[model samples]
Target chain A: MAIDLNGAIAAIGAGVAIAGGAMGTGMAQSGIGSAGIGLIAEKPNQIGIALLFLVLPETLVIFGFVIAILVMLAGGLI
Target chain B: MLRTERMQKVRLLCLKKDRRAVVHELHRLGAIDLRRSGLQLSDGSVGDEVQQISDMLIRVGGAIDVLRAYTDVKRRSQPTPVKHMALGTLLERLGSYSQIGETYQISAALKELDDQAEILGAAARVANALAGIDIDMASLRSDVLSFKAFEMSADQVERLKSTIGERGISAEVLASRMNGKEFGVLVAYDKKASIDDVIKGIAPRELDITMKELHGKPKEAAARIARELAENAKRRKELQARLRNLAAENLDKLLALREMLEIELEKGNASSEFKVTESAMVIEGWVPRKRTEELESRLALATSGRFEMEYIEAGEDELAPTLVNRPSFLKPFDYLMEFLSLPRSDEIDPTWIFIISFPIFYGLMISDVGYGLASLLLSWYITRITDPDGLMYNTAKIWELGAMSAVVFGVITNEYFGFQVTQLIGFQGIDWTKSITSILAITVLFGIVQVGLGIIFGIVNARRERENKLVVSRSASLVTLVSGTLAIAGGFFGLMPAGPSIDMAVLAVAALLVTIIFGGREATEVTNLITHPLSYSRIMGFGMASIIIASLIDKAFTPNWAAGPLLFIGFLIIFIALHFLNMILSIFEGIVQAVRLNFVEFFTKFYKGGGIKFRPFGYRRVYTVDADASDA
Candidate 1:
């Protein structure tokens, strides 16, 4: 199928959005997961709470995914 | 809709003889929290008792530690639930252990095992050292005919070489090349030639490694060490077996003793917090007002009318502990709030509010039945594997409830892990392309409502606190938030004629003027008009993100229809892995972001949380029951 210029641009935009979000979430979760493991080592009882805090920052990427999908869908690129 | 439980300050005074009984009764009732009195009452009698209890605690803890080590011989040490026994039952159980004098016996066994471990460890080290020497000896004896070995310094080797050279004794030195500590020389001199100078120059001490001695001594030592190691290992196994047997037989007794000692230690430590006089002990504590009567009755019955309790009205300056009483469904969310901050005594408990909003946001974020089912299963598994009293247990329960909510929401939305499940059954799911405008509008509208509610709550709180300026500013901000939203909506959507837009603008400006004129004390207060509404967009943002990711996963897994089995299997694995990861990310994002919105956006309006949670002095039992609680 012959894709239009706007469609290709929208697809790239979605990709960039998702990638940026993933990068941010990865950076945040790396620090949180490391510290959380150390905390779990000291107080094994804190595993659930530690895990919760460790994953809290992942919302950023999900938000990015949502925006990316919306942009693509709106631009008829999906 | 939200109210913190009332707390009453109480002073419990009893005779020194009734102190233990009174404390035990209070523990059974679980009403009062023993707090140190503000006034300094110089009494040191309880200090000695505390120290004695502490020492006993160490002994009991050490014994349990050893018991735990041996009992888990087959598997890893998992979390064991605490046991609870009635005081009478505990005392009765104590009699049996005391009669047999197992305490001393157990301690002795522990000591013997520790000593055996130490000896076994030393023997292992010696064996290792001997093994190293054996390797060196094998290398040394490989060519004894060509060269003779000497343990000497480098300086001695040099001097010996020179002295031998002067006597016309041609010799080649063969040193232990690894460290140059051991020296060797291959001599090619006449047997009659006098080599007294060489011997004098190198006054080497004997490593005693004559080729024969090297074989015989190492053999003797290795055999002795092997025997000793076998004996120690056998003894260690036997001791371990004995411990395991004892642990199996007397586990109940040991656990009971530990619990009893812990209770005694609590009582002993609590006594120190009490202000004791010559005749009586005065303990000050906070109790829930609703339970004050029950506590009073229990204390009377337990002490036989010998104690006096004076309930004091807590003053404004006093920091009373917060007691939150909520319905069972909302209790788990209360734990969520407590994880962050306990509400102050006078503040509204925001747990109910949290319960109302958190799950909704979480469900909205994930919005997929398959992911929700997975979450429910994962949480259920966590609950099953962990002890019921474990910290993760309640968290798992909370997740289970949230997952159920997500499942319900997902069903209504007709999505299952980004697959339009309803479409397979000839039903239409939500079309983002068609409804994007409405969704965004609704999202922004929800933001306006939440922020408006916050301002209204701020007004109520300010009014309650008798801050007139804050009340006026908050009220004005409420109007400003609403009118400003309307103004933007009307202008952007052409929802009304130009006249309504003018009216909305006028209303917004008028509210701002009121804020500036009447409530100018804090310039910062005006900023919430912009920040608060903007903050609520996160709810929509997070929700959209979840849907987008779910759809992406679905799109990514569109398998080739004509592919072979291996390719199909490969795609299947990738499909499961991708979707599984997306589910986890969505669940975490859903809960955390949802809670964060409420905590940051809603709570900042009315909730000022920083209070001590009511921790009544009692053993919160898990895996053990105090049978006497129902009776007393």
Candidate 2:
């Protein structure tokens, strides 16, 4: 049997959090890819800015973590 | 008839005066040669000019020296920028101090320093060549007469040792040679340093060998050779270090002067040729239209007015040489996507699609009016500040655009950030949980469609590549899509018992047949195709997994027991923290699902990536120009 209605709510929240991360990672990885091609076109020095853009998507994960902690505390799970 | 003219732009060959000064200066510098490879200079003066060849030679020579030094440093020490800097500095200092016409003197010094290490290495090698054998002491006492340095390899030497050790001969045996032969044989020796093995290693050498009596001098000669080798090796290390220090002190200066001279040449009336076709060299440059008469006069001095000059107008296309502005946000996206290598060649530009789908999908996935508003505002602001081409200035551009598409579904599903607010507005509340389940079901449906699309594309691309894997894999996928999709649709639509549909089951069986019989293009198995689509379930798994967890946490963690002020503050903190986590999780999950949607479902079937990207030989200027001017 389901633990409670709250259990399903938590389940959905977790899924949304994961999906959010996936979206960001895709954008980031592609950024990294294009940057690689650009650097190769120009040479290694072009890599600095490209690397920064590639890591920028990681902001999503930080946001996801925030949501996760909120969810946990709100439900008294933490 | 269509009126179109194919006219090559008219370029002045030279300024009316001798345009040689700047061209000559730039050739000496490494700027155009090394830094700007695709540099387009009007092919008027740079090439076929005096002193350019010597300049190129010097630059290439310096590069070789630097590369050699880099490898040498890497072998013994960590390769750091500081070491490179030291070498560069030394080159510069030596170059400036050198006497006129004595460039080779510095080069000669560098070469000499480098040679010392090479000589030491060669000397050690020759010594090793001289003392090539592993012989025991007892043999030295016997074979003292005639000894010659002979080359013996590891394997042959091993066999000789084994032969000698097994015999167990004593020192009493004779060491003798034939009168006219080069090599001598040592008679049986007692077991010393595994003697039997030594004899076995000494294979028959056809240097006209003969038997003779014991000798004493050769062993002494071998030991002397070994000593010489050790001393040479020690000297080699000392010499190498000295050369390294010398190079580190002077190499930089020489390189800098050379690079500076090269750039100076480009500033003059020199032209550079870039490769375009097999025979035609492409040279792009500008001359004042009014100055054409003077430029033509200069050209007449070189070619005696034999070469013709022409002019082509650069119309209002916005792709002007003077402009440099690019849409920052859109530009950043391409870099990001390419970094991930998400888009392959066969399909449409995903960037255009993403500009449409991402925001909408994000809003739907989030389902909070407040959060959507925040994203819309943030995206719009960033889009404006980051982009500012004037095309995307409104907040609705990001959220309302994608949101408009996603909200219909969001509203029907009653998902307003994981809760229904209909009752708060004095309306009967719809069962949001049920609608959410249905929405989730729809997400799965889309995933299947996307994956099915992949299989189709995979088959088409495979045929083009002439690879057999495409045929079977794609056929199997078709079968899976047909049977599985029919089953899912039938069940979801309530066409059957909500358990299994006969039509779908039959289609599934047919799909299995096709997969087993056709998809095994690799010849290893048939079950892979049926299972491959299952991998796509990861999309749903990741997406659903995040939402479910966030919702579950919200349910599990809502604060209830604390007092007024503390309780409110605590609740706020928890809500903020959890939302942060949700943001993180959602970002990762969205990327994963997006990738799954593309890579597995779409790309697996449709993507034929790995095409050479089209890069134009346009806008190769070094100076930054106004962004708006880039177009005109």
Candidate 3:
């Protein structure tokens, strides 16, 4: 079977988008998780609010995943 | 539903004799939050009384701690039934217990045992030293004994043995033990030779004679030490068992006494904060408006008409503590809202908005019937078993409602644990996959509605505060947001003709300009109005992710008979574990994103919170019971 160069390039682009998004989320959660632990230590009841704040940046990666899925689906790359 | 309870400032004047009873009744009623007068009292009598009460409180507190350690009922055992007593009955019981003098005796016994343990520790150390000696000590106690016990370096012991041999004095090594470079030696030397000369010639600098006198042989002495140790151990056991028995018998009494002493301590501290004179006292505090009458009646009954109380209006400069008053159903959401912030007294509380929208977003994000039912059952079981008023109970109720919402949405989406249940049953539910565009449109519409609600709430809040500019700008911003969204959608999809879209675009731009110039925040307000609705794309994004992951897990676990029984079982285990993990992540992500949209996106518009929570001066009966409630 012959490989489609354009589709492979598009797949690599999708991979880069996901990697950048995952890095962004990880960087954000690092700061948020530490601050969240400090907050929980001071006020044990803030767990829910702390968790909400900690996961706010997680949407960046989820969006990337959705975009990648859409690209793959559109291109029939599977 | 978003309002706070009204509060009133109260000042009370009572005779010095009635101060205790009035304060006691006030605490019992738990209506007022007493503020310290901050004026130093020069009266020595009140200070001395406070010190006395504090000391008694500490003693009783220490006794309770020792009892708790011994019995461990509060620490290790489940809660048991406790008798409820009125204040009078409690005092009567305390009086009877005091007459028996058992609490004091128990405390004294505990202290005595501690001292005895210390002494026993020292004796054990001495016994250890004696056990290292191997000589028959009875022979050393004879009238003509010539042996000397020496603890010295091994080199010194060698030198002494050589010198005694050369001097023609009979000496014999009885026992010797080495510790590093030092030696403990029991030596029998000639009685004629000068023992002082032998010690002075030996390792005099490194010598320590631990055993000076002996009443019996080494073996006999060791046996005696063992017997003493056993007696000490027996005594310690008896004391511990006695304390445990007392705790078991008088646990309720101990709990009540501790509470009573704590109450007295509080009264003493409050008295110190009072503005006191020779015959009268003045106390200031805040009470709920509805409870003022009840407090007045209680005070009258307690002081027998010897008190005068006055109500003062809270001034603009004064910040009254906010106590939110909502219906019972919304009370569970209070924990979540308060975790973010307590709403300011003058502003609207946004907890009701959260209660309405949070579950909808959560349901949409998860969108799986099987997972929803599982979550519902788990939360229900937890809520059933735990204390109803606790934090876990409230949180479980929130999750229970979220799961029920998910179930409803799952039925609409035709998904059950990632499988197309509607298709399996030969029916059609809303196929999210086939109608992705329509789903996207609906999610955008949901965003528009939420943003619209935010602007409306902002307008209403501004109107309440009589801020005309905010009301106008917020309303204009809403118009711009809605029209801009519709115009963009229409132009993108060719839903409308070119002429109308142009007109709609022109109208949107004009409203945006007005919102920017008049809203007083050019960049923030304009960008927020434009991008806020787009932020709701995450709703669709997260819902898609949940479905994708669930389907992936489901696809991985499709049964294949060719893999044989062991492989199939392995796959089954992996399927359960992976699906369980995915379900947890889904729930966590769903709840977080859903609440974040409301909290960060919606709340910023209308809610401004910095208010202090209202905490009344009272103690709840956690371990003890109030006979008044029991009677009612």
Candidate 4:
């Protein structure tokens, strides 16, 4: 197969978008977890707080899904 | 955040006195359990004749209760201690029996009865021995009591005879007993060693004492004989019939006897109530303040003005109460205890950390929008059953989160189920396969930023923890963040080849080294500080490896569009199986990586985890379906 630079570059853009999305998630994971620990450490009382943070990283993935739509739009896959 | 406040939170909600009651109440209600408690037969002390007689009577009752389990005709019969010399024949004595179940309760009644029987049997033999010698048997019998024990050996009898003869006094010997077990001595005597030595001098190896039921040739032979009897049609049928009839006739009577015997269980036992369903007596049970009114109402209805009711506030004794007939779904997560944790400024709970990273990693590794949707649906259903309280729902919600991530990532790569959609967008000469290179770039890119964030958090936490040294010490993280950022920016901006910005970034490296080598001296060695951040690079290496491995497995497993039915089916199975295996592996690895990040990357910077959590006194029911104790 001939190297399709245009298609490949498009793929790169899509991949970068995903990376950015994943970065948000990865960041949120550590962020929420550490924040939960910090909260638990101080008050040692907030199971609810820790639990909320525990679930917070999921928003990254949820929002990251927008990139897939962007990919479809940008690539004209639709 | 619920976690960041509440330092010096009063976890010890109950006082010592309250704790005692809590533990006591839990036991009374069969809520909490200790592994084992040492309870001796007679409090491990000698007693007067009356006390002794009562103890023996209780023992006999216990034994008869055990025998009643195996046989009928025990309705009116309470066990009576065997009158030592009254029954002169060992053959005529009664023995203890037990119910046969796979996990049988060791019948205390049977054991006590067996001990008393043995004592009386020995006494009878002693009486016979005295009679054989024609001594003042009556006087000797009255002054000297008899103890039921295993059969003594002939050599042991001879030794006794010799010892008595040498003393110029002729004494009567009553009983010679066989052990109920094997490899145990004939008697567990006060002087086991000396007696063993004497027996060794007198008896042959074959005749040395042994434990009953432990191991013995004769018993083994009997067991074999019994098995043979069972195999034979005639004997087997007869035995089976007898046992069936025995069960039919004795079942109800034995149960009734058990209840009667159970009543006796709490007669004098401390902190025990025998009247759960009996006479309406005011029974005080300590409960948490939250449940106090509820319990009062229940008691009021249960007693129906027949007895008084009192609800005591559990002070320090606030153990989780045992709810009777608890459901399987309601099993305690009380192990997730609160502690008087460290003075919190703003750190993170380990559990929350896990909850965030794990699902995202899972989604990234899977990188299949279709698969993520499947997982999200299945996990959502499981959450309803596992965490009805929404605890597990939120945890499992991450799958949906991951699905969303997968869809985004899949689109970004211009791929869906390994199909490139970017070419459809009219992008000229677009090659989707080149997206694989982007996956690596993103992996490293994300890793750099995450590592950077870890350092910032470390600095902030260190400042809050009042560690001035840590603030300066974690400056290396800031340096790396800047250097990595500059490297990516420079590369993107066409400033230089794909190397980190060394020209201006050298200043950051100098500061990084200063913090690492000097600032971290008290916390860690220069070598460790210099090398620790290097460890963060593993996120890139490991994360990339996971995605690549998954992608390869997916490709290898996917069926050929043109293949025959059987071949396609086989490939389909292989595909599903391989991906499933990869998923399971990733679940484990992702969690481990998340922990690694939390403990090594984040915690080492600013976390102090080991403060005893506060535990407030409360009542928690395991299940509503099974607290009645009727089935058990």
Candidate 5:
């Protein structure tokens, strides 16, 4: 139930990494999502391509998740 | 199965009299994609014929629309059997359907009736509004007095009456409740007075009724309008009944005529692409190489040896259309390929790779027995209800396959709605609680294999295109990707001896140099060799997220059986609903991420898809048959 200073800082760093990556992903996807809706409205068959574009930014969050895992391992928390 | 069907360019020269027969035969075969001939020839006659058929098509289309609006014509539950006939015979049959003219007249009459009903409906509304006045409508239109009808709130009418009285205007004001809060006020004043300004200041909505047209009292006029509206409705019904009967008798014939006319129009338009002389015409098209002999025999039979046919090799500069034939089960993946882009005729088709990896990715993302079973049932239901030829049905099949894979993984992981199912049966399967590191390692390794395969495919494609530089560069990329991955694993993770790790790192550096020397601008993508494989870490990330979330839901919402029945039942319902929501999210994320990994990450390495789809000339007939028995 208690944590050392180093452990607490590692956890905070992991949270920041994930939060920053998620915010960046969301920002990038907003423009792509709106433009993709317009494209799909004009050409419904392009739904697959629109979806692909909309999800392309998700790798940012995935990378953040990997970093968080590494941080937890270094702090002996996982 | 990895490559597209080969194609050959075909040129056919025929006598002018036999041109129609040859074109008709080609249409029935439905194997060739017609192209414009190189010779410059006038197509005035063919253009005229195309215009004629197009006009007929428009008329037929209009009639079908009219019939559909009037009646709920039953769609055929089963596809209609095709009727075999020559083009001339089909044209004659279309001409014999006399109901076409009757339908046109009926459509015009219906349109007129609609316009009349609209006008009458508006007049009826006005008459009903004025019915409470109990005054002769014609008398309200006196030339010697200023008459006006205003609709306002009852309180506003009271204010207007008092204000007009205060203004010392000798006028008669009549008020009647129209509906709800609305009061109709009619004011008549001396024509010479300036009382119009007083009424306009009230800001009431003025009604525009032609008083001169209503000769009788307002109530009488309302009755008359209602009667006229009824009469119009009756006439519309009778006309609609006649239309329904006509539709019942001729709807199928009209539909067949429309199809035939469309086909004829396309054939006529194709003639514009042919080279025509005074007594001969030439047609050029692309045909699948395997079907060339069939095309030759069919043309020979159709023209009785009057046509001369020759095959030419497609030039290297020309891009031929891509055509790939797969079994029925693999057809759904083809839809995915088409949605992205078709592979070039000479490049490898990556659909087979997707078929192998997409389901694996999906299974890993949503590995749970209960969720997999639910997805399988949902997909099966969608497939049953959707059209077989439509995109929805194909996508459902893809989901069905992914669900099966999910079930297999779910068994291996011993998960059922996040519960350890094997624990109840006195055995233990793979405990995800202890296998996170192993799973992450496996996912990263899978990424390495896929990326390596992609680079190898790129090498094969470059070699096929005789791009020697691309071949060597891509080979170097594969070597670098493999050796660099091993070096990282051994050096950083201590998976092997330090000596081998150092040696692998050296090999990786040497491969990187080769890549830079031959890869041109592509060498700048060296960092992607590390990051792209690391991207596969997402599979583990999402899979663990799903499991953790499901477990949390179960922990939080599980009902206390020891509580009273009512509270326990309430909590149980909430528990079921949350689990259902989690399952749906899992399905959605599973499909999007699985397809994204394949299309965006795996495909970018080698696939440069700008290939034209092979669209053979001719309609897929539902009501008409191929006249040539051999082609059929």
Candidate 6:
């Protein structure tokens, strides 16, 4: 259960990476989700198009996840 | 399976006398999408008829709404059976129903009763609130004195009395416990005293008994109001019964009449799209090639062999509407296609490809038997409750298929709610902890294959469209993707020998040059050629996250059998709740991510979906049948 300073820093970095990505995704989706509701209210059949745009920003978080995994691997943690 | 139904542009010429009949037959056949011919007819009769039918529709629609409101009939899950009747018979039924003055009279009487009942109901409520007060209701509204009644807490009533006393307002306060735990206070003061301000300060709700109808003591007033209410109720019941009986007798006929009027209105509207001359009418539209023979036969019957018909090939610049017909099982996938966009008539339909790949992506993302079974049950329940024709039901069917795929993958992986069932059976299964790299490779390879297929499809589409530059660039992009993937595998993963890596790297560079040269401004997408396939690794990432979260929940909340009963039961509940939450997350992420991969990553390569949907001119009749079908 004891971790070296470098290992701790690496874990913290991974956490920060994911946290930053998640917050970015949340901020982007907050605007999209609200606008998408308005769009769907007026034209319900555009729900699929709305969802496509809504999830488009998810790639940012996926990249962060990749980075987190890479950090863990480099840190010999997983 | 990969293309929309073939269509032929059709033009028809029929005698003006037979125009309406031919149009009706065409609508009944439901084969052609009627298009507007450029020629305009100056005839104002069709416009007048459209207005007349519209007015009739409004009256019939109102009657239907009124009748439906009075009845407690549940909507039928199956469509109402069509009653075969000649057009003339339909018109006769409609004419008879329209002339029934009793239904309108009943509606008017019911409205009058409702108005009366509302007034009486309000008086009854106020009378009930004023019960047990002995003062004359008229004196409470006297011009020389002011009376205010309030329902408030006992403490608030005491405070109000003291507040009035402090203000030096000469008022008589009567307080009594009303229903429940609240007190009713009646305050009387001189009209000149400005006591309203003092009462407003206390913030107690004041009861209004200002209606002129109440004159005697509260009890007597209540008695009079009750009598009126009973009479009002009696009249309402009579009107409602009459309306219900009217509905019972004429509801079906009224519905049929409405259908006939709506159809007549549609024919009138469609006539505006026709090109009319002094003695002839011309109509142009697209018809599915397979249905042309049927259309010709039906048109011949309708025009009595006096119509001329011709079919022509669609022009290259023209965009024909798309129509794709699939088997019942594949119908749900059609919903997915429509969700994103429909394929252009000339482009290959990617629905069959998505049908095969989507479930696999979903299964890999939600690879656990317990969650899979839960998803299946959940989707089954949703499918049962939702309308079969709605998007939600189709989505549930797709979910059901994905859940089955999940179960298949779960069996292969030996995962059951993150527990390795293979361990108990002493059998070896793919272990995520030890085989992360291999799993990542497989997902990436799957991504490459799909992306490669997309590029190949792009080339095929471009070649068919005779866009030579597009074909060359797409071909180069495909080569670049393959060589770049091999180079990365060799250089980073040590999957291929170093010599092949050098050759692959050189080939990748050459392909990129060709892509840049031929792709014009779209060459900027060269970066996506590498990043897109790598994006599929999120599948493995999300699946691992689900597994790790489940494992953590198990470790943190799994009950100790040695613990006492209460503590053990508490932990067990938390354990199940956490697992349920995890399953929901897994299912949601599985669907959104799987669909995202196909729609955004794979589809962006080839799909340029702005195709119009084919909507033939016809109403699916529910109450009336076609004349020819009726004869049959």
Candidate 5: chain B TM-score equals 0.91
Give the DockQ ranking, best first: 5, 6, 3, 1, 2, 4
Residue A9, model 5: Cα distance from true site in angstroms: 5.6
Query: Where does candidate 4 chain B have its weakest 10-residue lDDT segment?
Result: B35-44
Model 1 accuracy (lDDT, Cα): 0.69
Q: Each candidate's root-mean-square deviation in Å?
A: 8.1, 17.9, 7.2, 18.9, 3.1, 3.8
Ranking by lDDT: 5, 6, 3, 1, 2, 4
CA displacement after TM-score superposition, residue B99 of candidate 2 (Å): 32
Question: Global lDDT for candidate 2?
Answer: 0.45
Expressed as tens digits, the lDDT of each residue in A11-65 for candidate 5 is: 9989988998899999999999999999999999888888889999999999998
In the range B443-524, model 4's lDDT, one tens digit per residue, is: 4455455555556766776776687777777766566456645754575555665444565367556766667664645434
By lDDT, who's the top model here? 5
- Model 5: which docking level applies? high
Among the numbered candidates, top TM-score falls to: 5
Q: What is the iRMSD in Å for candidate 2?
A: 9.5
Scored by DockQ, the top model is: 5
Residue-wise C-alpha lDDT for candidate 6, range B280-376, written one tens digit per residue: 8888899999999989988887787999999866665778988889889888888778767889988978888888988999999888888899999
TM-score of each: 0.74, 0.41, 0.75, 0.40, 0.91, 0.88
**Tens-digit lDDT track for model 2 on B34-100?**
1122325333334442255345546545543643463343332221111112223434543455331
**Model 5 lDDT tens row, B228-281:** 889989998998999999887777767776777777877877787788889998
Stretches > 4 Å off in candidate 1? A1-78, B15-17, B39-44, B72-227, B327-330, B384-396, B494-501, B518-522, B622-624
5 or 6, greater by TM-score: 5
Q: What is the lDDT of residue B117 in candidate 4?
A: 48
| Candidate 5 backbone collisions, by pair | none
Docking class of 6: medium
Task: Specify the CAPRI tier of model 2.
Answer: incorrect
Model 1 TM-score on a 0 to 1 scale? 0.74
Indicate the worst ten consecutive residues by lDDT in candidate 2 chain B. Answer: B206-215
